[model samples]
Target chain A: MADISAHTPTSEIRSAYLEMTHRKRLYSGLMLAVFVALMVSGFVLADDRNAGGFWSGLHRLFDFPAEVLSEASEKLTDLPAHFVHFLPSLIETVNIAAASTLFGAMIAIVLSLLSTRGLARWPRLIPVFRRIMDITRAMPEIVVALVLIFVLGGGPVPAMIAIAFHTAGALGKLFSEVNENASLKPVEGLQSVGAGWIQRMVLGIMPQVAPNYLSYALLRFEINIRASAILGFVGAGGIGYDLKNAMSWGKGQYDEAAAIFLLLFGTIVIVDQISSALRDRLTHGARLEATL
Target chain B: MTTVTTDVITDLKGRADTLFLRKRLLGFALPAAVLVYLAYIFFAFDIPGLADRANLDNGKTLIRDSYSYKTHVTLDNRSGDITYAIEGERKGTYPDGMRPDWVSDRDGMTVVDLGRGNSVQFAQGFARIVQQDGLTVTARPDRDGVNADLPAGPLPDMISASKNRLMVTLPDARVTVTRNRVEVFKYAFGWELFFFTLDSPYHGMGFPTLLSKAVSGEAGAIWDDFWGNAMWRHADVAWALFETILMAFLGTFGAAMVALPLAFLAARNFTPLMPLRFAARRLFDFFRGVDALIWTIVLARAFGPGPLTGALAILITDTGSFGKMFSEALENVDGKQIEGIQSTGAKPVQRYRFGVIPQVTPVFLSQVLYFLESNTRSATIIGAITGGGIGLLLTQAIITQKDWEEVSYYIVLIILMVMVMDWLSGLLRRKLIKG
Candidate 1:
């Protein structure tokens, strides 16, 4: 019996290997067929002659100019023009973002309070409010701009609205989550002393989550500045408009664009540095309080 | 007993007085009223128009009728002048004998003599016939170019009637119809009219015109025209999306990359030096304080407008995020494995590679993958500011008063691209983590 078992040893391993190989081949073949079908359909249905010609022409036109500019700019300046232009737009973009973020944070606080189960009379409404938050967050800022462009007639208002709405959604969700996960000891103690919801929130929950809120708000501000730069593309005037103009012209003015971009980068770096420092202070303060 | 109870009550009242103050008559009520008023204003302010059934219907009609006109169109080319017998029986007809002189052939389309001075301009899939007087001469909108316009209202029945009858207008501004815009009742002919003439053959006016010129082998000229003149003409409205993407990517990735080393320092389990850990933690907070877009504009100004500027902006913004996230993950790592590696007389580098890395690699990869997917869309936004890619295309389409068809096309393409990136990133993340 021992000899027979030894003879059949490792048969299961071999069979499993064989089965895996067979499955792999099947899946590959299926995927290949689908890919081929797609290629064939695209070729057959597309206006290939027109599309191909147009693409080739566009490549030639844009590429040739870009090449010439790259060479000329190399000779004329020590640095690329794109570098120079990017600097200022970057700064303005930061300013817009910072303002929007602070505004968004203020709004988010009120909205979060309304959405929170702990504060609401009808706690069941929390889910409904959460769903609304989800919908707002789900939309990209671009889509928001598109919709608001129509209503607001293509101005900073649309961009501002888009940023505010998205920030509110993001911050509200974060605030609610933080509140839910917070330690209940302090809250309970306040409640036991007959403290109202507002008082408890101000004294207990806010203190615990304030640092986190500030950090998140700062992060959002950075994001909003970038978003504001693009808002110009939809006629919400910003640095993006000038950049588009430069590229479209295919002139060597990439220096201007570069300058603007550099400005944006530097501004962001400085702001980020400052924000991180502040965040460190807050967190450290929180840690000290916790230890005490 | 009564005196004792009174004293106790007095003491309780005195304690309450210290905690709460009685307000003047309307102090609290005034604030409440103001709050209510603000809420009312917010709710009452005009909300944007919803995409309701009626609005969509109106948009559809607008698109359909804008293309539904009959006119005798004459094309002027370098080879010669070619005349087309355009028959428009409906409210959307191209007028006969209309010549648009301002339309140059070099510009891809031109108008020629249709037996009179009246001109018709044909480009892309649609044709515009303007009377010498410079008013829309084909089909007058019933409500003075408001209500009865094809885009604003329903398709008029006049189109069906002029199927066979070639109504010709003299260059002298004389208009004539063969049979009063009556419907032809023959199946074969009717079918041809419905399928071939009324329906759009090319995708839209701008695309087809551009494509047609390109296919004609003037590819370079077409591209130059598109990029130089067309794109810049709407620059203010087309670069925003590009800027947005650039900012997001730079913010997310920049933060992640910078945070990598700091994360190591901040990890109590991994960091042998207590001071380094504390410093890294402090640094992480400073970086994360500001938002990403703010960084973008700042960088844009510092670097100038381009993808690099956008990237730098994103980098700074993301540094804080990645630092915090990475530090937390580091703290949560299993201490036993770290201790075991340490016991083997492994150096800090070896311990990190064999112990900490193995544990945190999955989380790090997942975060990176998520950021990449998010950044792809963000890249488009940066491109809007930096003047590159599809965002620029979208902005141009909107500003030129071009048909929404082009706008829809760009949008759908962007969405599909984003979906593909999302799917690809998700797959890579799962495979890398093997989870």
Candidate 2:
């Protein structure tokens, strides 16, 4: 047999071994520092107030309304007052969220198209658009709410506008990213056949990315729904208005608040299940196509 | 041959022309019109006024004049010569017409001499009043003087006394004077005070009163008042913020965490199982199908109200997002490394640990940190539900009719908090992921 050891250089082998050991030590030190930092930070920030005063107070404040609600239920001798109080607001909240999602998605679709780098002929415009998108996404929805509240007055309009603007920025960015990553083969083929920019996008790009776009749009809708409900707190008009009123009432309205909360929790769970199922179905179909 | 070529060219031209027309109508004109209309509406709306309509000045006057006083004085007669002194300020001369002379002491309170006729009258009240030559007056009430009442009009703009019974020059500035233990009103409008007044509400709503009385300004007092009474009183509003947070968290982490399992299935290198990979990919697509906020509304109806509702909504939506992200990360993992691990006869679990996990952990951690920061803001949106956190406070401040000061305060706080959190999280992520 040939002397394999002679063929390989001893220096190269030794250097490789040294490099591996150095890497291991460096990694170990880094991990140790990270672990120590996490522990120290957690301790430093931990709330130290007495449980009786802080936690109990919070619990009592949150639970008092539930107690009253249960009492009211007993006294009324009819349908549960908790349910009755919360049901309407819950429905309205849902409706507002749904409507906003639909509208936001519609707005996002147009914005996403404008945001696409490939669609823009001007290279300079691409970075500008990207930066604009980043800033828009960077701004918190509350800031948007504050600005819109001034323009739209104390109503759902401000909330809707805030939600819509944010959704547009976020969805636009996602859409553009999807577009960038999409298969260029079909686009090139269309271009070779003398298709224009719009033709290539519509026929080649859109077809490939449509499923992803739809999925994203649906996901945004869910987010918008939750967002719309809270918009009422800022005078944007939603179920949150009722919640604010109840909370302001303090001790007396706990039960109603709890009931409302429960309703909200329930609503989300149901929507989550439904959307998840739908998502599964859609993804499963995509997977089947990929396998073929 | 020329006829055939011309006919083919005409057909091609016709097809291109038709296609252009279709594109213009559907892609350009329609969207453009919609955009214009929407922009018009946004521009057309009137924003709320920034100014507070409440008369805070009147309340400030009440507080200043009604409660703030230094000395107590009463006069038996209006024409009596009186002398008075504050221990710390000064004591020199009083005007001849009003009072005789007064002496300063180490303590704040001082006694003054009154002229003959004024002496008896000054004795009934607390201090004797001596008319000063300049704009100053030296007034000292008798020690027994207690019944001196405030003038019925708005509180006096300024008050000062000469040191002794000699006249003294007075500045054109406003000052506060009190006698007979009555509250003195000071109308001095320093810029800091003025600004504070502007930011605060008038009467019960003003910041000074609220800060001094309601919030107490003690350590943890503001937090207690805001979180407990103010925030709890508006539970729905507070809860809404919690909901927003739940939305962001669930949307981010729920999706991200689930994405890991799905990612394994979707990753071709690891799975090698085509059906599983395809199924996982489809799963990611389905979850990522819609925007998170949309999911919130849809879920809000089904789930009802609270953080759970928001969280579930976010979770379902984010799962799709994370699934796509994680799978992409998985796909990009080095195949040779995984093959090397497999060559060692490592089980699938071990392969993931030694091969995939190490490769993806840094990316995953960074992504999680980014999402966590993003979600903090998202929580504010979901908190609009009426019961939760800062969002509720924010909305209420806006709605309670031009509580802009509070609105500004809360907005600043939230923004600062978010920025700090983002920075901290970024630092942490870098530390965690560092080689």
Q: What stretches of model 2 exceed 4 Å from their correct place?
A: A1-39, A46-85, A121-123, A150-153, A182-206, A248-253, A287-292, B1-363, B379-435
Write the residue-wise lDDT of candidate 2 on A70-124 in tens digits: 7456555433666785676666666555555656666655556556656554556
Worst 10 residues of 2 chain B by lDDT: B85-94
TM-score of 1: 0.48
Q: How accurate is candidate 1 locally (lDDT)?
A: 0.55
**Interface RMSD per candidate:** 11.5, 10.3
Q: Residue A288's C-alpha lDDT in candidate 2?
A: 86
**What are the per-model C-alpha RMSD values against the true structure?**
14.8, 14.5
Q: DockQ for all models, in order?
A: 0.06, 0.09
The CAPRI class of candidate 2 is incorrect
Give me the runs in candidate 1 sitting further than 4 Å from their true place.
Answer: A1-92, A146-155, A183-204, A242-255, B1-339, B342-353, B380-397, B400-435
